[model samples]
Target: MPELPEAETIARALAGILPGRVIRSVTVLREDVVAGSAPQFGAALRGKRFSEVGRRGKNVVLVLEDATRVVVNLGMTGRLVPGPGPGVPPASTHPAVLFHLDGGACVAYDDVRRFGRLRQLSRAEWTRWSRQLGPEPLSRSFTGRRMRGILSGSRAPVRSLLLDQRRIAGTGNIYAVEALWSARIHPRAPSNQIGDAGAVRLHRALRRVLRAAVGAGGTTLRNYRAPNGNEGLFQRRLHAYGREGRPCHRCRTPIERVVFGGRSAFFCPRCQPC
Candidate 1:
C-alpha cells in the first residue's frame, strides 16, 4: 500500500497537470470503484473543470469547478496514469475509471486487486470525511511537542502507535519500520517508555524518512509507481523494512524480522534498543 509520501507524490504530480483541464466525460469500468450511485458519479463530474488536485492523508482529492470533490483511495496495486493522447491503451489489468479531459489528456485509475475506491462529495461534506485523519507529519501542526503529547499516554508499541492513522496520518507498516530503524528505536518498545529525548529523535526521524521517501518517489515494495509508470527508488535506500537477516548498515548485527499485528516488521536487534 502506498503511504503518505507516495500519495503526496501522486497528488503533487496530478496537481501540476490536472487543474485547468475540464472533464469532457467519465467512464466507469467497474461499478464497485464508484462509491455512490452511478448516476450520481456521472451527474456530478462529467462537465466539471478540475480546480485543484491535493492529498489528504492517503487519499487523493480532486476539486471540481462546481465545488464537487472526487476522492480516490488508491488501495494496494492501484496506479493513476495520465496518458499523452486520447487513443492511449486503456489500463487493461484493472482499469476502474477513466476521465476524458478537454485538453486531450486522459487519466485512468487502475487497481489490480480491485480494492481502490472513488467517491464524489460536495466540498462542504468533505470536511466531515477528512476529520477522521490526524495531523500530517510534514505539516506545521505536527511538532515535536505534539508528537510527544500523543505518545505520552499511549501504552501501545511505538511502531504500532505510529501506524495508527488517528494519531498520525500517512504512516503505514513500511515507513513505520523504516522510521523506527532510523531513530534507533525498537518496534515493540512502549510508546510511553520513550524518553523526551527519544521522542525528539523519533519526530525528526519520521520527518526525515518521509521527506526522503517522497524525494525518491516512494518505496516500490509492490505495485507502486509514479504518474509516469516509473517504479520508486526508495526501496533501494531502505535500511530495514524488508531486509530480514541482512547485516545492519551501521553495525554488524543481522537484522531480524517479527510479526506484529499480523504484519512483518524488520529491525536490527542490536541497533534498536528496547
Candidate 2:
C-alpha cells in the first residue's frame, strides 16, 4: 500500500506542477476503479483547473478552482504518474484514469490490482470525510502525549494500534514495523502495556522514520513511484520489515519475522524485546 511518505511525495510533486493546469479531458479506462458514477466523475473534472494539491493520511487531495475535491486512495499497487498526455502513452500499460491537462501534460492513476479509488466530493463532503480520519501523524496535533493517550486503553498489539487509521492516520504495515523496530518495541506488545516511556519513544521513532522516508521519496517495495515515475530510495535504508534472518544492525542477532493477521512483521529479537 502507498503510505504517508508516498502520498506526501506525490502531493508535493503535484503541488509544484499541477496548479493552474486546466483539465483538458478525463479518461476512465477502468470504470470499476472509480468510486462514483463514471460519467459524472468525468464531467466534474473536465475543464476544471487545479487550485491546490495536498495529502491527508494516504490519500491525495486535489482541490479544483470551483472548490471541488478529488480524493485518491492508492490502495495496493496504485501509481500516479505525470508525463505527456494520453496519446503519448502513459507510464502504466493501462491506466485506470487519465487527467489530460493543458500543455501536453497529464496525470495517470494506475493500479495493477484495481483496488485504488478516485472519488469526487464537494467542500462540505470533503470536510466530513477528513474528520473521520485521525490526526495526521506528521502534524503538531499528534504529539507524544497524544500518542500516549491513543495507547492508554487499547489492548491491541502496539503494531496493530499504529496501523489503525482511526488512531494514527497514514501509518501502514511497513512503517509500523519500522517504527516499532526503531523504538525497540516488539510488534506484539500490547498497546495498553506500552507505558508513557514506550509511547514517547514510539512517537519520536514514528516521526523520525516517516520524515526520513518522505525525504527518500518513500519505501518502494513494489508498485509505488513518485509522480515523476521515480522509485523511492528509502527501501535501502530499511532496518527491518524484509531482512528476515539477516544480522541486526544493533545487537548482531539475526532479524526474525513473524506473521499475525496475515501480515509479516520483522524485528530484532534482542533489540525489540517482547
Q: After aligning candidate 1 to the native by TM-score, how far in Å is the CA of 141 from where it should be?
A: 1.7
On residues 98-132, what C-alpha lDDT tens digit does candidate 2 reach at each position?
A: 89898777888888999999999999999999898
Clashing residue pairs in all predictions, respectively, total 0, 0
Can you list the residue pairs that collide in candidate 2?
none
True-vs-predicted CA distance for residue 216, candidate 2, Å: 0.5
The lDDT, on a scale of 0 to 1, for candidate 1 is 0.87
Q: Give the Å error, residue 126, model 1.
A: 0.8
What TM-score do all the candidates reach, one by one? 0.96, 0.96
Which 10-residue window of candidate 1 scores lowest in summed lDDT?
A: 84-93
